[model samples]
Target: MDDGNVSLDRMRTFVRVAQRGSLSAAARELGIGQSTVTRHINELEEALGVSLLGRTTRRVTLTEEGSQYHANCLQILRLVEQATEEARDARRVPVGVVRVSCTSALGVMHLARIIFAFQDEHPDIRIDLNLTDERIDLAREGVDVALRLGPVMDDAMKLVAIGASGRRLAGSRDYLASRGRPARPAELTNHNSIVMSNVAGSEHLLLSAPDGTRLMVPVSGTLRVDHGLAARAALAAGRGIAPAHLWLIQDLLDAGKLETVLDEYDLDAVPVSLLVVPERAGIARVRLLVDFLVDEIRKLPGITPHRSASG
Candidate 1:
């Protein structure tokens, strides 16, 4: 090995040159002189006592040893970078546009409240929320953070399960009075069920009978909407009985407009998750938002029991 002094900058030059396949292109990318890039690569190769690059008029090529050395260099550099990023303030809590993606229902129903609360904690940050019912590709969409209902299948992003909400049957006192109170889960089949359309395609609801026989009923109604808020409103209007998030109907229920049905049956719970691409979540503005939102979600009335406790 040629005993020569090498710096991080020279290693960077070598990597850049190898990537571009030419010193001129690497120099252009680095905004440095071509001669300087060549010097740095030469110096790095001399220091390692290995031929890192074979220079030609047309392009640069790597030898067998150079290929292995390049991989090691990249890994080492990445490790050092990650450590540096952790030590530095990722600048996560300041004011900036954080692009957030979520389903239209959640973004419209719950995201606004959380965003307001998060903004109160971080006044500088501005949230750009994109609402969609369809699945969005985070990388293609260029979203910084996303609030999702239920589990995420993609492992490319990190997921934090903030909390969950369950579907509950609700209807107005008038609607119940008009249709008559259902005596059992089997009775639901005879009544009008305000099914949420997106969920109707699947069998997510559980129904149990008087004889202790559990039946999973795939329900339907004349009135079905995608949004939870709309379903709650429809129920309050005595339009039809609907399945909804309990928190969304609390005020309506409190006002005696809506009543819960089939409480005895075991219903499936929907998970709320925070999906963040590493680049943004690792930064300050996004980090603060994720943390704040998680805290608020935990305190949500639907998920938490209302009891005497210390703050």
Candidate 2:
């Protein structure tokens, strides 16, 4: 059997038959006659010089080799379908649903607006936005693109560095007034603090000083929160001081409800990144949204733009 005789049509027919477990069922699914399905399978086996299917009068089953071949065929067919869609989309207007994910806080505060604006521009494009703080599997969850905050540990996904999300120590004006503002980082221990339980190190704060000095200040608080919106509410209600991503509290700061504490000190900036599924990266709609998101994200206040890099 010559390997050159193997064809995608044969592989697809084999996969369908393997999945359906019957030649008749596979033929029906493929809109072909059962005889055609039988011929395709026979051709595949003859070309490969291996018996792929265990045929029976009632049902069919895959041999060990067939199972491996089926898995590979699934991947190949998916890639081919994707490539076809991308090519077709390139010739037409960018139109389709693009699934997007973002941290809840950022989504509510900024990304929602960006997405809405994008939909307005590309009226044919629709967005399915998933908002959560939990790190999720993009491929498993069917997310086309995601705005990820902090370190993106997965080097598998294509990552574009949007910028560093600068954080600031801040509290409500009322809280600062009632408790008295801490003049230094160490003095934060005396104040009632609002801790973000979702962050890695909630018990301690690492701050950089104007003099290029860095210090790790241990902190404790009565109010421990996981969600950024909850922490923002606690801050607005004058619960306590907490380190916040500037975008998180920018509205309150503008409204004079919150004030930056220890302006001379800085917290380590979190990396703001856009993650794209490698397969979806070529789709016209996905590419449009990704480019739009990156452009708009750069304009966000408190986010420092840097050279974009892919991992």
Candidate 3:
């Protein structure tokens, strides 16, 4: 086979199709017609002398060789694009689209402010911040950076130690004052624990004492909520006692609207992390944004974020 027979477009089509899992999906994401995408894939497979995809009625998956090729292609393609972009931006400051994702609480409570500040400084950088509790695929989801809590399993990408955000059993000022503060972890069982179950519903809680003791408490409530904002409201409204991230409840706690319970047990605050993708690992723009986020998140009153402990 002639090396010249393989075009970059064909390689790109293979990668995109692998990521999206179907020809139609690739076409949608690449903004090309399905026929064009299929043609590219067929051409690439013929050139390489191997079947790249195993297509079924419902979906498409890569063959064993295709999987390896897909991974290699991703690394190579990203590096090529990164180099080109770096050369173009060498004279200019770091500026371009930066897609960031974060959990709901921090996204609203902390990340939004930092992104606004980053935008103010880098006027040319278009920021896309996706706030969700769902785990994100940085490559597949097109995320550049993620302001995340807890641990990240992947070793390849970089995680900048943000700050510590241990959870605490807390309730609204009205709830605590009216219901009386929980003197012990076991006392949580006695309270009207509002469980933040999704619409489908389930009750769970990871509660702790100030002394570093922990307990996983099964909770039931008059309301089972899913959304963090709604849960916060439910907590604030004295709907019931629930565990909350330190950052999310900071203002309310300070305002004396919410009070922490079980001060004796040491509760593991979810380790705050800035999940940076490999593509942006060394990019000045990404580096700048990650640093700026780390700085800003630390300034968040009452939240403790730190490097996640390796398990």
Candidate 4:
């Protein structure tokens, strides 16, 4: 078939009809009349010289050749759409709805503020922020970007390192005064520990000494919480010592509301990263949001921006 004879609109219509199983349903989704939908399918079949759909009064079914063509059509349509979006994005004015997913603690403590500030700067872009601790399937959920702590779990995602957040053992001033500070990591067993259930390895505190020696101390507490914010609140209220992100509790630590414990040991930094769906990575809004986050998140207290290994 000549390239000029094939229509992108017809391909889209056929794919939609294949998915919806009815011309009326595809027409409704496309905001076109049923007659136009039928015309598109007929034109598409004529161009390809094959019947793409077996139509019945009840539903539409694909023939064997139609099934193969449908798959190819879906990929072709996606590429065309992506190309169009890329052309539009070349203008550099990010103008679209970007859906973002992040943990509740990070969203409430820092991400929310950053998003609002970003929205103010780019008034044309709309942000839909979903805050939850549950792990989300970005593709399934239609999330453009995700801000996550620790390592990127999905290898399929494009990972951009935002920064490094180090956790430090902290306790309220009153709690420290009443319970007495532990002279060594081994002594932590005696004090009440505010365990964060959400954090991995919360049951044990990993401490490293100045000489590069590491110690894994078993910890238990009366108060255990699943959320990071709740755990921080408990630690700040003189409950017990817990490993808290420096960015989250820096203000309290500076104000003497909380004091750092076992200062001699250097704790490793947990990498904070932004995950973008591979297909969405080329979108202007997603790229802009990622760069914005990389710049702004580094500005937060105690957050060290991650550098590439070559850098």
Top candidate (lDDT)? 2
The backbone clash count of each candidate, in order, is 6, 0, 18, 0
Q: What TM-score would each prediction reach against the true structure?
A: 0.65, 0.75, 0.79, 0.74
Off by over 4 Å in 1: 1-93, 200-204, 208-213, 304-311
Q: What would the per-residue lDDT of candidate 3 be over residues 1-311, giving only the tens digit for each residue?
A: 65665877878888888877889999997899999999998878888899989999989999999988887787777788789668857876777777798888678866788788888988887887889888877775567888776677868677777777767778887887788987766667778987766523236555454554567766666776667787788888888887777767777887888887766655566667777887777777777787788777877765564546321
**RMSD each, Å:** 10.4, 8.1, 4.3, 7.0
Better TM-score candidate (1, 2):
2
TM-score, candidate 1, is: 0.65
On TM-score, the leading prediction is 3
lDDT per model vs. reference: 0.73, 0.87, 0.76, 0.85
Model 3 quality (TM-score)? 0.79
Clashing pairs in 2: none
Order candidates by TM-score, high to low. Answer: 3, 2, 4, 1
Model 1 — which ten-residue stretch has the worst lDDT? 302-311
- On residues 11-124, what C-alpha lDDT tens digit does candidate 2 reach at each position? 888888987799999999799999999999998899988889998889999998888787778668658867877777868878767889999989999999999999999999
The global Cα lDDT (0 to 1) of model 2 is: 0.87
Q: List model 1 lDDT by residue over 1-311, tens digit each.
A: 54554777886777777766888988997899999997888778778888888878899988888878776666565556545545555443365567788877566767788898888877877887888877776754556788777667979898777667766777889989988987677677777877777764542457554566767765667876877667767888898766677657777778787888878764556777778977556766768788777777666546642123122
In Å, residue 99's CA in model 3 sits off its true spot by 3.7
lDDT of 1 at 230: 74
